[model samples]
Target: MDPKVITYYFADDGRIPNHPSLPLILYPGALKEKSDRIESIFNENNWRNSWTNGVFDYHHYHSNAHEVLGVQSGSATLQAGGEQGTALSVQAGDVIVLPAGTGHKRLNASPDFKVVGAYPNGMNYNLRRGEIGERPQALEEIGKVPLPETDPVYGTEGPLIELWKHKERD
Candidate 1:
């Protein structure tokens, strides 16, 4: 009596059951769960400004996303895969389980980091949408990459992104 020994429990997005590009879709009710004009929930998304100099620019990977970051104020460092500089100093609630290829970065940015993210996917966008053969050699190495220090919180006159360059001739 062994019908191929059936035993199924497919849910290891990150660990136990919470990884599919950070998925755990649920919304019930509890401590002030008021719905109306605001509910973008990716831990109340608003932490834009990520980088990687040398024209490398956001190298990606994710076989089944599961990004969970919860830091209620300042502190970030998440560089995965390459491990050239080594980063992973997450703070606050600190509930990590970032599986998949694990290549993320949001390092050293704190005017109060403030985070709360929960992802649990099984529908789509565990993104790896390819079509980039390093467009023109990564825009000729991001036009000879530069800018490592000058970060007075954007006052450093940094991000003016527009690689893929080659503009000469009057």
Candidate 2:
């Protein structure tokens, strides 16, 4: 089945410095029948340095790399875009693509919750809590982080690429 794409935009909000051009992308139930192959799927699409774990409980953002997370085992309530962001519930097979600098935190989760996360081309990622000191530099890094060559869950022609590109052109 084709996955439905959902998009959201989060403003900078002083501290988090959410991506200015790209909106967060969610593909619900994209991998429902193939949750076990999530890692391989991301790797095949050039999203590498994969890890399997639950999200951090505190809000944080990555300044240097975009991130993709595939729900592998259970369910979670994740807050995206810092304190003013949206809270989303996700279960196995859900995939979230967060552009660089988008804030995220795990509000709650099932005991068996597990997700596989990866970055484009195995790019190194930096963790930055919503601290006052991480301002301009984080903003700069976020602007410099390039778009991923391909979507983590889908291949080259996924909704992610189109949505992000369309936003950039606006």
Candidate 3:
């Protein structure tokens, strides 16, 4: 199925300096009743190094690699793009793709809210809480992150590849 991609451009918000090339992608209900199918898809698409857990409650971003979060069990309200960002209500079978430097936090969740997260090429990730001192290095790292060869949910021809590559050209 196709995903509904959402793009967010955040300025140097004095805290989190989000990415320029990639946008946040939301594939709502893309895995409905098939939450367990995510691991295999991610692995097959080269999005390896998977883990299952709940999202963090406090706002944070990854500076090393992009992340894909598949909602495996329950529902939650997630705040993306830092403290002043938008709030999103996500449920089971939904997937959220966050580019490097995009801030995210779990505002609240149902008791069973579980997610499977993975990185492309099994890339190791770094945690940054938008501290003032971390901005310079984080921004540099964000710019250096390579684009994923394939979309986590959809394959090579998905919106992620098209949009992200388009953004790079512009």
Per lDDT, the best of the predicted structures is 2
Q: Which whole-number lDDT from 0 to 100 does residue 90 have in model 1?
A: 50
Can you write out model 1's per-residue Cα lDDT over 21-125, one digit (the tens) per residue?
222111112112322211233223321122112111353434433333334444466554433423556544332334333345565655555554433322122
lDDT of 3 by residue, 21-107 (tens): 577888888888789888888888889999999999998999889999999998999999887888999999998899999999999
Q: Write the residue-wise lDDT of candidate 2 on 1-170 in tens digits.
A: 35599999998787677888899999999999999999999999999999999999999999999999999999999999988999999999999999999999999999999999999999999999978888878888887888888989878988887787666611
Q: Sort by TM-score, best first.
A: 2, 3, 1
Candidate 3 weakest ten by summed lDDT: 5-14
Error of 2 at 63 (Å): 0.5
> Could you estimate the TM-score for every candidate?
0.23, 0.96, 0.94
Residue pair clashes in candidate 2: none
Span of ten consecutive residues with least summed lDDT in model 2: 161-170
